[model samples]
Target: MKRDRSGHFLMAQNARVLYVPTTKVASSTARLLLAEANGTYRPERLRWTDAPNISVDQGIHNLEVSGLQYFEFLPETQRDHILKSSNWWRVGLLRDPYARLYSVWENRVLLRAPSPWLKNFQHKCSEVLIDGRLDYAASFRKFVNVLRAEPEIFGDDPHFKSQRTHLGGDQVAFTHLFRVDKPGELDIFATQLGQRVGMKIEPRRLNEGLGLKHLDVMDAQTASVVEQIYEDDFDAYGFERVSFPSISPIALASVGETKAINYARDVTARLVQLSQLARYRQRSRYLLAQILRNSGLRRHKKHR
Candidate 1:
């Protein structure tokens, strides 16, 4: 949806942070922080939904364009307004690909759709066997094949040069990019984000929504299978070839609670706004249809 000139400028100036949330990379926690910083933060609405005032026909075309154009969709007057505004910056976080893929699998399992890869993993078994692990090279080969066949499923494109480019467009200049493995890096990132926004943001609950419970308790062989499946992401994101961390049961529970609470809060707010907008659009369309039909009938009567 196209925002008004004033709204667009305000967003560009006050909310320049464009978080390219890649699945399970503490995206919830990052969104929560952004929400607290700006009371009007709507990550889902920005990425998924258009503005309520904007026309659906125009909005669909805007969505089809690349990310760079999407951010500056306002008229020339609005674009100038945003350019003059202060406090504009972009930032995002990344996670270990292998771990993120595992988390994805775990979430799907909870939703009763485990192993989106093989399609039959759900019917096969709740747990995966990982003893007779495939070699990294072989795993990489399979991953490449899948990506080549189904770019949409893997979230890749022919135009994008790299995975990051595919995610955040070529021109988006990020002010900060933190890796999940180095939790401490988040603090530095927060400091920079605070500087840009002109406020101090104490980083807490860094790895919110990520927990061991979500992780499928798999054998070494199964772990290798998943690792192979996500080799490209690993290489792209700079994941070290280290054994997965053993998260204690208590710690896992804490993580789960944090994730649930944060997700509930963020998702609820977004859904409410989306529902209201949808209702408004439906009502507006109904009124327009009625007016158009009456106008047509009036014209026909006059001709007769």
Candidate 2:
């Protein structure tokens, strides 16, 4: 709220950009660029270690919930520093709600399958009703129901009746909001941000190609259902419905290749290690059994 001279200059020139990373958006790519630009931009360090430069514990909403007090938690000088920090911009990326929901499902399929206590309690409604069948509509309904039932979790305040009305009050705070649909707009945003920060940043790809898995298989009916469920997000973000052409073999092959590569590079490492450990354990058990049998034979011979 308190804008210093340099802050004003940056705002006038480009505006301070704070990127609120939402799941499934091109947040990773954006973070990478920011880190390259500013050595201070470290997501993992902020999340894990209590890094001084970045406050990862309190998200945008937390700042809004406890404004000056939130800042006061840091040293008084640090609070002042943040207030006067120049080229400080706040921005966030949000996705088509339905698409985001689908991505959440795909990414967390295993958690939802067994209905673990944490997953069940936290995301009961979103559970698949039938095994091996993905009912998008049903899932959406359950999600909505969960939100409605536990308003406090999604609501701006525990006392607020409607979360939507309470948005932007003291819970949801941002200077600029960018929709994932308009990627070109992000380039313009990045250029402006560069000017403000007095640093050059090439706009690399943001959240693209993430929904490829569902994009090909997402039927018109399912898409329509998603559109209806996430109409609010679509309207807010100006998301236009994208209709894919008939699935081609070439397209399918490309998708498969990409997935395979990602799995091999990112997923296989852990699995391979686990497999080796299991094999070792099995071999050890077999050797122990053989040793016990040989000992038993020796005892029998001595007794005879």
Report lDDT per candidate. Answer: 0.45, 0.44
As a whole number from 0 to 100, the lDDT of residue 32 in candidate 2 is 51
Candidate 1 to truth, TM: 0.49
Per-residue lDDT of 46-68 in model 1, one digit per residue for the tens?
44553432222222222222122
Poorly placed runs, candidate 1 (over 4 Å): 1-12, 42-88, 112-173, 203-218, 244-304
Candidate 2 lDDT, tens digit per residue, 1-304?
Answer: 6432122111111223334445455554455544444434333433322112112322212222212122223455853444455535555565555456555444333222111122234445443434434444344445545544563443322121221221222333456566654557667666666765678887656324334455534555556655665566566556778774433212222445434544543453454455456667778987887787788842333654
Lowest summed lDDT across 10 adjacent residues in model 2 is found at 5-14
lDDT of 1 at 211: 43
Task: State how far residue 190 of model 1 sits from its true place (Å).
Answer: 2.7
lDDT of 1 at 260: 56
Compared to the true structure, candidate 2 yields what TM-score?
0.45
lDDT at 163, model 2: 17
> lDDT winner among the candidates?
1
